[model samples]
Each structure stands twice: as structure tokens, then as C-alpha cells.
Target: MHTSSTNNDQTTELDALLQILTTQVASLQASYRTSNTTERIPSLLKLKNLETLGPDSDPSLNETRRLIVSAATQLIHTVQSPIEIVQDYAGSTFKTVALGFVVDVNIPEVIRDLGGEKGMHVDDISVHVGIDTSYIARVLRYLATRHVFKELTPNVFAHNRISILLCKRRSFEEIKADPISRFDDAPFAAHVHMFSDEILIETLSAFSEFLKQKDLSSESVKDGNPEDTSASGPQSSAGLGPRTAFNLKFNTSKSFWEWIAQPGAKYEDLARTVAVVMRGGDKMVDEGQLVNAITTAASGTPIDSSTTDITNLLPLVVDVGGSSGSATFTIKNKVLQDVSGIKYVVQDLERPIDSARKFWAENDPRAIETRQVELLVHDFFTSQPPSCQNASIYILRMIIHDWADGEAKKILKRLREAAYPPLPLSTQAVSPEPKTGPRSKLIVFDTLARYTCDDPRENLNRSGKEGSTSVPWPLLGNLGVAGEGFSTMMDLGTMVALDGKERTRDDFEQLGKETGWKLESVKPGKLAAFIFSAF
Candidate 1:
């Protein structure tokens, strides 16, 4: 009789859930109608961003995408059995294995070659990539269900938007000719390889072990606050294997980068792959580090170009560890037309600097020849004493999160040492607010690890104020599944790989205090401003 009552309760709950799902789907359709030009679902899939979109594409569809998918997923959860959920969860490891398989096989490329949208038979695709037809079909089928590939019919497939970018190589001319295409597809591949590959995923797989073995106070606690591992259920139970995870898995006194950099090391391929991926991934992720986020901090400062050479007072955008000047290039391209006399500087290791030289030479020789964009081959770890009188902004995008707090401090301290510059004579004045008196800032743009809330959907912080789309509920609370994919994956990935972490604003604020930069303003989306306090 009790079991019957419980079943009745579940039925009622499922009915309510179905109703909510219906409403959400309607809302999504309405939102799409308003936000997009096309009313057709197929047309929407062909949107320009879709050509290059991936886990971190800019001009993102964060808000709407979150709403539609989360609603569907939540609905599935409500209807699906507990046993089924557990089974899928356990079986999901095969998903990663399948991804690795196709990626390694370059299956997407083969599909494209066979005949892009028209697709080819499984046998042809298998023959082209030289894989067994049955095995390839099975793998392709699994990915198609997840929407990696479009299975038009039985044993036939084609490249959908998502599958297109999975191809290992891209035609530079094609990407350039089509301005709408994302130029960072190569780096995107690198990132995909980094995550989808065995070694990196191993770290994430041991997320459960990260807890049981990790000393809470080890200073190198992985990204996200130790106190808050919300939404992602019991993390100690999180890792499947008890013996190893994260730090224990890669037990070494040497840092992740150092270990990877060792001469002719066996992990060389992994390191090189990471290097390429890091370069490309920057283009996608750096857009979040808006120039306005920096400029807004200087909003009140009155700039009288007449008082000083306007050129001297022009804002400086510093891209520290900005590989191949990709981030700096975007900043320069965006700001060059509106703002005159602005200087863009990209500082990185020797190899990347050389690569940047080649890139600029080919893409915009005038910038390099004219010295408008300075590509300085300087390692970031050393003291970055100011060479010029004043640099308006030092942008450390996606850099600090690569290290533990101790090392992050070291990086910040170097910038703090270089942050303050003596005011240029013309602008120096007794006035409380000089519009253009060598105002300087250090901007750290990365994820501001928010605590996982029990009722994440309820506490959804629509960060429109910080400048990103807001997610309504049918969307996961923190967005999709309450900050599941990029947020948590990266947070944990870095833990095992580098002993680094994505930190909370409080964590950054504390670091500023320790490093001697006053936390001036914090815009949402993790853009933190620190003023140079060197007296």
C-alpha cells in the first residue's frame, strides 16, 4: 500500500514536471523568435556563430542555450528512473572513450571529405579513415545521439555544426575569407584534445579522490572554494577509484609546466598539444575579458588631452602571457578605429613571440613595422619592471588561474611592482581627479568561482550587470546543470594538471591585499580591477 502511494506521488511529480517542461519549451521558442531573425529550427542551427561555436565561443548563446537544454535535461531526470540515471552515469565513461576514438581517427575530417552535408555511408567513412566499419558506425552512432555528428539515416552520417570544428585541421584561407568564421578552430582542437585525451581526463576522473586524499589546507587546493563543492554531489564519492586522483595521481615536487617543459620529456607531445590549444582557446575565452571592463574602471577619470600629449595619455592594453598576440590582436582591432594613440603590448615566451611576429607579418605587417603592437618576448614570472613611463592596463586573462594561490601571488606581485608609473609631467596636478594622469590598473579576467548553492536555480545570478547573458530557470541555476561543464571541468582539470585553481572574488581580493594592489572594482564574469598603490 505504501509503495503504491509512493508511485502515485512520483506520477504526480512527473506530471508537474511535464507541465513545466512544456512552458519552458514555449518560452524558449518565444525567446528565439525575439532574439533571432529566423523562425525555423533548421535555419537557427545555421547561425553564423554556429560555424565556429564550441564550449567557449564568444558572442555566446549562454542564456537561451542554457534555458532550452536544462529544461529538457531536467524533464528527462523527472521522468527517467533512478536506476537508469545511475546506469547512464556509470556508462558515460564510454562517451569520453568514444570521443577520443573519433577525434584520434579524425572521423569528422573524413566525413567532410566524403561529402560535407550530403554525408557518406558508414563503410565509405570507415574505409577512408581506415577503421572497421562496424566499430566506426557504433562510435559515430553514439556521438550522433549526443549531437556530435548528424546521422541522416542508418549507417550514414554528415557534419553538423558541432562536428565540423572537430576536424583536426582547418583551411586558413577559408577561415579568413569568411570573416564570420572563428579563427581559433586550431587552438579549439588543441583544447578538445587536452580534455578528450586520456591523461587530462584522468585528473577529472579522480575528482572523487581529490577530496579523500587532499588536505584541505594544502594551499594548492584545486580551483573553486574548498568549502563549496555544490551541485557536484559528494566529491569524495566523486572519484571512482579510491587510491588516486589529482595531486596523488601526478605526485611530483615540480610544477606542472616545469614537468611538461623538461627536455625531451615523454610528456612532450602532451605539453606541445597543450601549448597549441592554449593559444587557440585564448581567442574564445579572452572575449569575456572586455576592454570596457577596464575602461569602465577609468570612467570617472577626466582626460584632458590638451593638458598632456593625448598620445601619451592614450590607454595601454597589456596582454601578459598572451600567446602569439591573439588576445592583443583582438583588443587592438576593436579599439584601433575609435581610440587613437593607444598602444597594445603582448608579452610571452620566445617561441610564441616569434610566432606572433610571423602572424602579424602575414596578417597586418603595418602593425609590426609601425610598432603599433609591441610583441615582447619576456617571460612573465620574472620581475616585470615598467620599461615605459605608464601603462594604463595590464591584462592577465586566463593566466593566474593556471597556478596555485602561492604562485598566483608571485605573478600578481610582479605586476604590482610594475603597476605604478610616475605621472607624466603635463598631467601631474593638485586636482583630485585628473582625467589623464598616468592612471594604471591590473585586470585579472577569469572565472570568479561562485559557491554551488543547494537551490542553484533559485539563486541564479543573472550577470547582465557584469556583461553576459542571463539564464532563466529551465536553464540550470548557475547556467547549465549549475555550472557543470566548463566551470567545474576546468576547475578540476587544473587541479590535477597544474595545482592551479579558479578562485572566488574573495580569494582574489585577499590576494590583492597580500600583493599590495587595492581591489578597486569587481565587475561580474570575474573582471577584477586593482589600482597601483606603490607610493
Candidate 2:
């Protein structure tokens, strides 16, 4: 009888502890929900001094606010515990693409088939994705820590609303079906890319050594032969592995491309890595542009689109490097949904052609059958397609930053030749020519070089105020990038992987003038990207 009484006392203590935890979680949930709701509706007072959008705001701000809030809420709901939340944010970088891959591959469907979604005892997402369950558990556990998905119980998984949205499907009709389409699809292959522990170690090691080198010139050395692990640099690094040790011993002698192009090298890694970045990079860009458009289109600060003339002046627009047709689709769906005779052209490398064609085939029959949107496999480095000569607006998203000034000029010069080929001396205009008409406007969307951009911290400040930063999203918080890892990675990754560098607003202004494309204006958006226009 005494033992029974002691057991009841223990049960009473357990219930009290449970009550405290329950109250805390409830409080957290309430705080998060309130913060998220407030973020969707920016105060009119907050619009002052913003570059991306002006005091003149999109008439559709109310609608956009509603959609953005709903999406953000669902995304936040995926994490249930503080530990899970921190892990979710901590593992966000690697797991973002992993979750993306599962979505791309339809892993959730397989899980649903095995009675997992219906509350089965086991829901092993890893096995469903064809990997060992333990590995998947580790990956998902990290992901769950970040809130990408959840651990309903050990080894069992369930989709948070965010993960549910991630499942490959059309969020809206006539837009790109999968979010992956908007971006370069290489990120979907991140699982394969990260498998190269050698490359990761080498890259990290190289960066570390380069960081320590007192003389920047000394940093250019690399292993003489891409195949030779022995080409030398620093001393006393014999304990390291071939790749890491090699980096410690040598500096990169040439640009990254030159190093990677050495004979007998496995180019697959570099190529896929580029493709993955190119793909994932696109979504960040497109989302940034959408935000910019919503903010600016109403004010006409950039284009004076206040009157009906805005519609008639430049009705049709084509995105030169538009991947998966996301930008084109988003613009049409958001701004020109009811407008007629609007044609959008999405061009990209040959690899995306099949994917693009398949995308158009499976959805948007009007776009496909009527040719409202055309997906073309055209290289940006090559001549501008003849069809683009008369396009009212030309949009290139994140394409310019991939190249330096010389190559950028070549691309722009080609665009000039395509749009306004120089007339022979015999046909020269009698009077000094004035820039007028549609102007074959080229809209280049890219991030300005952060090292020099005037408002480098504008986005971060806004994001922090938005509440995503104040509380910290798990993975982002750890990375010190709770707001937007996409931009952060873009800035850092370009420095490490490619010779391509981010530019400043002044850098862009100068580059535009040098290339013959007159700079209309450069508008820095809320997402930390700049929308540049030249005609």
C-alpha cells in the first residue's frame, strides 16, 4: 500500500512537468503565430526610403500579403519543438536541397503508399528514397531539427505543411509546376554533389589556406596536375589527406576553371556543382524579382507605369535566361493574369530543354497549345535569338553575375546587335538619334556586390524586423543567416567556386555604360538583390 502511494506521487509530479512544457509550447506557438501574421502586412510607414519598391506600392499588396502570410505560416508550423527548431535551421543549408530532391523524386508518395501518412507504426523516408533507413534518419533528424519535416516518434516521419508544399506539384495553374523549374535543376542533384567528400575537404582546405596566406599573390598556386595529388606548397602538412594536404602544400596557380579543366580530371563534379548552383540560384532570384515587381509596378518609379499607357507601352516581355519559366509564369499570373496577347519566352541551356518541354507539356495547355509561353534551349553567351529583337522588355535573371565585364559586354553587344544593329554609314540618321520607343529594354536581375553596395544591410535589417530574424530560424540562426541563406550563400559561394564576383551598384552602373547598355536605374529590392535596367 505504501509502494502504491509512492507510485501515485510520482505520477502526480510527471503530470505537473507535462503541464509546464505544454504551457511553454503553447506560448511559443502563440508568439510565432502573431509575429508571422504581422510580417505579412508591412506598415505604410515602413515603406519610406525603400529602393526596391517606393511609396507607390502595388495595388495588389493586400492579396500578396495574404498569400505570403499563408505560405510563411505553413512553413513555420513544420517545427514543433525548440530543439527541433534549432536543428531545422542549423541543417537548413544541406537539407533544403535534400528535401527538394525528395519532392522532385516523389518520395512522399511512396511513404504514403506504405500507410505511413495514415499513421502506420513505421514511416521510414530514407528507405522510401532508396537509402539505408539509418542514413535517412540522420538526414531527416537534422532536417527535423531545422523544421523541414517532423519526428512524430522515433524512426517515424510526417510532413509538416511546409514539407507538404514542397511536394512536387503545381502551386498555381499556368505557372511552373515544380518550384525546381524556376531555379536551375542542379540543386535537385545536391545529394549526388555532396557525396564527394574529397571535393568538399579540398575546397574547404583550399579556402582555409588561402585565408591564412599573407600575400594574396601566393594564394594563386594549386596542385600542378589535377590528377597529381603531390604538387607542392606549404611544409609540415604531411598528415593531411591527399586533397586537403595538397591544398595546404600548393596555392591555386590559375583561375578555378583552369584548374578544373586539367586533363584526366573528373569534370562531372565541377559541371554538376555549377549546374546545381545555377538551378538553386534561380529561385532566389525569381522570388526577389517578384517581390520587387509587386512593390514597384504600382509606383512606376522605374517605368512610369501609372497610366493605361503602362500596359500598352510594353505589353510583352521575355526573360532571356528564364529557367523553368518561373519568372515569366509568376509575372503573368500575378500582374497580367487577365491581359491578352502577352507572350513570355524562357531560354536556358540545352540540359533544361527536355525538362522545360516536359513541364510545358504536362501543364498549362493554354500556354503550350496557344504558345503564350515558349521554352527555348538557347545559350546566353551566344547571339540573341532573332525573335527577341522586337520584344518590349528583356529580362535576364542572375545571368550577368556569372560572368565578368568582358564576357558581359559580349553578351550585351550581341543583344545590341540583335535589337538595334548598327546601320551602315549610308543609312545613318540625319539628326542625333534619341533613345525612344520600347527601347528593347533589358532588365537584368542580380545581386549587387555586397562589399560595396550602399545598402548592403537593408535586407537583413528588414528581415530582422520582420521577425524571422528576431527569434532565429534554427539553421539560419546557427549560420548567423536566419533571414535568407540563399543570398548569403550566393555571396560566399561565388568567392570560393568561381572567379565570378558579386558587383556593387556603382560597378554595375559603370559596367552598363561600358557595355553600351544605358543604365536606366538600379533598384535594390527587399531580398537583397538589385534589378538593373538598360536600353
Candidate 3:
């Protein structure tokens, strides 16, 4: 009798929670002008967070949009989990096959070339794409159910917001058409191809094995390869290859860089894609913010006007380990005019230097002609090439956290040492130190994961639509997949691909303290964090 009463009480509590979720969902519909009780998916899909239906900032809509998404998520899972669990788990194979087919054959491009918003008939699309009509239709129809593409009529198809990404081009094109390369510099395509072909399959087989090999019984696997991170180990070329899953899978006795740098390595496309990915930092805090931080911090020390010589006022911006020099271009464009005689330098390996040179020559010839941007081949794990050391500003984007704290600190320490550049005496003479000036500032751009406990509805701006404010306990800062999304996925992939991990603000704090640098300020954005550093 007591057990029955307890069950009844628990069921009542769940029923109440469900009622709350349903009430909020209804409120969301009413606010969005779809309050009609009969409308089902049309209303559900209009919720904005669920689908990419394009931007609509209706003033009359309720401000707490995240609540609606959260409530709906909870309610849907509650109602669908029993049935969805089995299908979603086992059905991945079919979806993978269908997605792989479309990606491999460039179906998205065909559908796009045929008609984007208006869409194309299945027969016409198949004919244009040179695939069998019935087979393509069956696969697309299956994908439509998953919201990848849209089936307008029985045989017609249209590009949804998601499908448009897989097309050769983008509506908001951040990456440009690479005329030099045979493959399109399509970031999404590269991501899909790499994930589906290399990363996903490689990870599945090696993720478990790596743990077992590293002695899963001891949980200290969290410290990923301490020797590789230490000052001495990074200098040595031994025992670094097998530490990574990609190296292990390929059975290469070389580090990721050495392996990729070999002639005919066949990763040129992936290299281009990575350049696009590195430039993706623009989605977060404005590039100008970093520009402002560096320039302002380096200001106030004026050259003596009594001498009337501007030759001693040379300032340098070194983007350390800056693959492809993506950020370098942005920094140069933003501040080259404002800060006269400032030289922009991108220090990286031979591959990135070559890639950046090609990209910049075509993209921004002014930078090349003015001779403002110089690509220097220098390894970050070593001392900054003396030529670029003690620059006015040093920026590292996504460089740290590729190894354990031990290695991350070594990189930081080198940057710290380099920030105290020897003062150059005008034009031809070299001096030991800057006569009198501020130390160069080091700014790192990466994700600074943190739990921000704030009311979701407090900051009532349409910016709220970003869903980046503090989410409830279960969700991430971006309201991404309940605590496991791109960052988490990439974190794991880094472990396998490069033996790296993402760091929290605390981890950075420890790294900073150990590396002889002070944490100036942590500007956390919706996606990336701009961490400031000083000696």
C-alpha cells in the first residue's frame, strides 16, 4: 500500500512538470501568431530554435525564446524518448549512407543549381545530377523527415536552410572561391567529408582502444601526455607520434605536422578547410576589439618629438602559431591605417606560411604590395624567431590546449620571454631592450568554458535570440546539445586527432600562473573567449 502511494506521488510530480512545459509551449505559439490549436508542425517549426527558417524578429513575440525551446525540448524528449531511443541509435547507419551519398555526389549543388527556394522536381534533379530518379528520391525523402532537405511535393525538392550549407557556395560567404585548388574551398563540405570519412570512423575504432591502452582503471588520463607538454620533451622529436589516435591509425612514426608536411600527403583540401575554420573566429567578438586592446595597451609611450625622427616608432603584430594567417589579415585591415608603420607578421610552419601567402596575394593585394604582412616560418614550441620577438602585440588563436597543461605552459612561457623584445635602434641598428615602453600584449582567442549563472530572461535583447546567456543546469552556454555539442565533440576529436583538449578558465588560470604571465581580462563571448595576457 505504501509503495503504491509513493509511485502515485512521483507520477503526480512528473504530470505537473509536463503541464508547465505544455503551458509555456502554448504561450510561445500564441506569441508567434500561430496560437491556432489545430496547427501542428507549422507552429512547431516556427519556434525559430528548432529550424533554420531565416530571421524574423517580431516585436510582438515573447522575449523568453530560450524558455520555449527548452520547454519544447523537455516535452518532446519526455514524449518521444521511449520510441526515439531505438530508432535514433540504430537508424544512424541509414542516415550516414544517405548523407554520404548526397555529399559524395554533390546533390546539394544540383538541387541548388536547379532552384534553391523554389526547389526542383526529383526527376529533374536526378537527371541534372545524373543519378537514378527513384533511388535519389527515396534517399532525399528519408532525409527530409530528418529536416536536412525539404520535399515540396511527391517528387519536388527544395533547399532548406541546412541543405543550402552543403551547396558549393554560401549565402553568407566567409570563405572565398579558391581558384588555385581543384576542390571548392567549401568549409561545410570539408567538414562533412572529413568528419564522415576520416574523423568519425577513425574516432569510433580508436577512442575506446586509446583509453584501454592508457590504462582506463586510472582516471588520470585527463592529463594528456605530460612529457610532450614539458619544456624538454617538446624540444625532443621522440615518442610524440603514437600519442595521437590519427598517428596511431595511420601508423606514421611522425607528428601530425611532420606527417602532413610530407610531399604528396593528400591533405591540401583539409588544409584549406582548416584555414576557413581558423578565420571563423569572426563569428564571436569583433576583430576590432582585439585590435583596440593591443593598440590601446601599447599606446601612451610616445617618441620624443624633439628629435623629429619617426624611424624608432616601428610597431609589430605577430600572430603566433597563426595557421594560414587568417587573423593577421583582419588585424592588418583594421589597424594598419590607424597605427602607422606597424608591421604585421604571421609566425607559423612552412605549410601555413605558403597557404597564407597564396590566400593573401589573391584576396588582399594591398597587404602584399605595401609589404605590411610578412609570413615568417617559426615554431612556437621554440623561442619566437628573434626577428619577430618582442612584437608590439602577439595574438594566439586556438593554439593552446592542444596538449596537456605541461606543454601549454611551455608555449606560454616562450611567448612571455619573446614579449620582452630587444629594442631596435632606428633603421639598421639593434639594441638589447626597448629604451622605455610597455611589454607586448599576448591575446589568445579560444573558448573559455564556464558556468554563468544568470537569469535567462534578464538581458531582454533580441541578442537573447543567440541563446548564449546562462542556460538552465542541463544545457550549455549556447543552448547547444545538452552539454555535449561541437566543443565537446571537437575536444574528443582533438584527443584522437592531435592529443589535445579544451580548457576551462580555471585551467587557463593555472597555466598563466605557471607560465610567468598574468591574466589581464577574460572577455567571454557567445562562442569564443578573448583572453588577455601581460608580463
Residue-level lDDT of model 2, residues 1-535, one tens digit each, is: 0112234544553343344345544544444345523333333222122223321234223222322332243345443577867875675447545664454445544444453444222335554445666666676666667565566677676665444434322232211344333323335334334333244435644665545552444322321121212423211111112322233434534344344445653555454455565566556544545645534432332233333444234344667767677677777777566656666788876656676777667756578678778788776655667665545566777766655454455556556555432323442232223244334456677764432112423333222222122221111121223233345565545444442346655676666554445554455443233333333
For candidate 3, lDDT tens digit of each residue in 78-177?
6676777677866776766677678766777777665666778888877665789999999999888889888877878787757666664532121224
| Every model's TM-score | 0.73, 0.49, 0.71
lDDT of each: 0.59, 0.47, 0.58
Superposed by TM-score, candidate 3 places the C-alpha of residue 477 at a distance from the truth, in angstroms, of: 6.3
* Rank order (by TM-score, best first): 1, 3, 2
* Candidates, ranked, lDDT: 1, 3, 2
Model 1 global lDDT (CA atoms, 0 to 1): 0.59
Clash list (residue pairs), candidate 3: 229-407, 423-433
Candidate 3: C-alpha lDDT: 0.58
TM-score of model 1 (CA atoms):
0.73
Query: Which regions of candidate 3 fall more than 4 Å away from where they truly are?
Result: 1-71, 86-97, 115-118, 121-135, 170-183, 198-200, 216-239, 256-285, 288-314, 359-372, 404-406, 421-438, 451-484
Where does the lowest 10-residue lDDT sum fall in candidate 1? 231-240
